[model samples]
Target: MTNNTLLLFSRLYHHDSRVFKEFLNQLPNDEQTMPINSTIKFEQQTSANHSVPDGAITQESFKIVIETKLYGQEDIDQIIKHTDSFDGEKNKYLMLINVHQIHEDYKVKIRNKLNEKGTDVQLIDTAFEDIITSFRSVINEYDTEMSMIIDDYEDYCNGANLISIEDRLMRALPVGDTLDHNFKYKLYYAPASRSYNRRHRYLGLYTRKEIKGVGKIELIVDADYYKESKKFKWEVVEGNKDQLTDEVIDNIVQSMFHGEEEFGYQIYKGHRFFIVPEFIETKFEKVSPGGLLGAKYFDLTDYGLVKEELDTQLIAEKLKEETWK
Candidate 1:
């Protein structure tokens, strides 16, 4: 078969949106639409399972909780399989993850373990670096290259092999001295499977004014999910008028998109998990500093719906949204 069809998305903030949009131009006939006035809709976006101190330590700004659900190992295997299949050769893959969504209980489970185990530091670093050097063995081991982003230095140090700046500099000095993977290294900081070690687009940090004019809310849903189900987190609320809660979204997803028979309810350990992660949509609105955008919902579906509602409500309250068009 021919590989004529290609799918692309802007999953992270650091990723230049232009790269993806440019690909669309190559399509024989492609049409797209975007929002006129967009906010810094994460304009940005992390997945992390944080490790917690036993017996609970001091207070924290936000509570880290874990919500586990049990999914059949077969399901997970299938997911991994599908991920590999879709992220084929030539088309590099990066799991653009929002690591922040895990429940408080789940978040605290991923802390660094102090496994001294009498493992020598030098040996450990050497082993780790050696593993990295031999990790892929050869270039393009399989489908979907892996990269991760860790926000804190602790995780970063633990997860990534400390890149030698001096070594890199010497290697990069003129064309005489350069490493083979330099091209890959220069393009991406890290190639990891889990979001914990991978970078994410943090569009939530900036304000609407920060994003200024990001055009209309052009969105690319999670690839497979978009193709299989013509609905997205935000679309659920917009099209279905759901409350935008996890349970509600789950209900919408199970009832509407993928029926229970086609794909059983995806429960991991004990919590219901969405197969396809959330996507950010560009929207326009005004708000008082820290003013409630009607109501804030952390769940992607609810958040998207609520944000859209607030934008609409604010637009109705103001003449600006109408003026934008």
Candidate 2:
């Protein structure tokens, strides 16, 4: 079914306009819990559907006007013109919502115009991506109705291709076991190669986990810091290996297995190990001794690594299950 942005939002507010209050509290530095019994209006107009605001939530203490543009760029003048329409004595705010992208230039231009007009109306810019993030932030506290509403909104965003790849990676972190203590993941948009005309998506796994016996591990997958064409020079940036007088490589290997029963051991020549061309070094890198020098994965396959070849939606679903746990 075709979903209009306004209708989707109406459904959300229909569930409980308190969600709107929750949303306001979620904004940075706007931490006050708004009073209950607020009223929501759709297609708010000066007379009858004239100078209409996309939506608004008004209460005794505050008024919020939201203008949503899902298909095209928003006209900055629309919001600027509405600053005079607010009649309440409470604090007032105007929010501009977009689906595809938010232009930094738009904010600057609006601020400049407001300054010229001596308008004190506060402006807040947000996008569908931001809404999704905010929803995820509080999904744990949502009741059944709120959860369903979130699911529908998320499905609509995905169907519209409005969800960023980084969003998927961030959502997947809790599900993946290979991550480090923080389970952080970052997605990079790579510039066009000599062959392709457009940029491509690349993901980086910054951390991983292992049994206590394995000591420590770090992984960087698909980052520019390590190249497949180049060999990695491994060093003991810390620990007693740097003080070794002889058999440094052997000593490091011994340290890896000492006091622990592990089958795999890494062997290298001298202080440097040359990675082979066949190794490719694309999927994972085990960070060397120092700290976060190189990128690699720890227990990736078992932890649900989402790669290009893997089904992202499936992994996301699985991760969502893990997140609630």
For candidate 2, what is the lDDT?
0.44
Q: Write the per-residue lDDT of candidate 1 for residues 47-160, one digit (tens) a residue.
A: 223321111101122111111112111222222222221211222121111112223222222111111222111101112222223222322333242222112322343444
- In candidate 1, position 288 carries an lDDT of 45
Residue 126's C-alpha lDDT in candidate 1? Answer: 19
The candidate scoring highest on TM-score is: 2
Which portions of model 1 miss their true places by more than 4 Å?
A: 1-252, 259-325
- Residue lDDT tens for model 2, 163-220: 5443222211111332221121111111122122111122233333211111111111
Off by over 4 Å in 2: 1-20, 28-50, 71-74, 139-142, 166-325
lDDT agreement with native, every candidate: 0.22, 0.44
Clashes of each: 51, 10
| lDDT (Cα, 0-100) at 243 in candidate 2 | 36
Per-residue lDDT, model 1, residue 192, is: 20
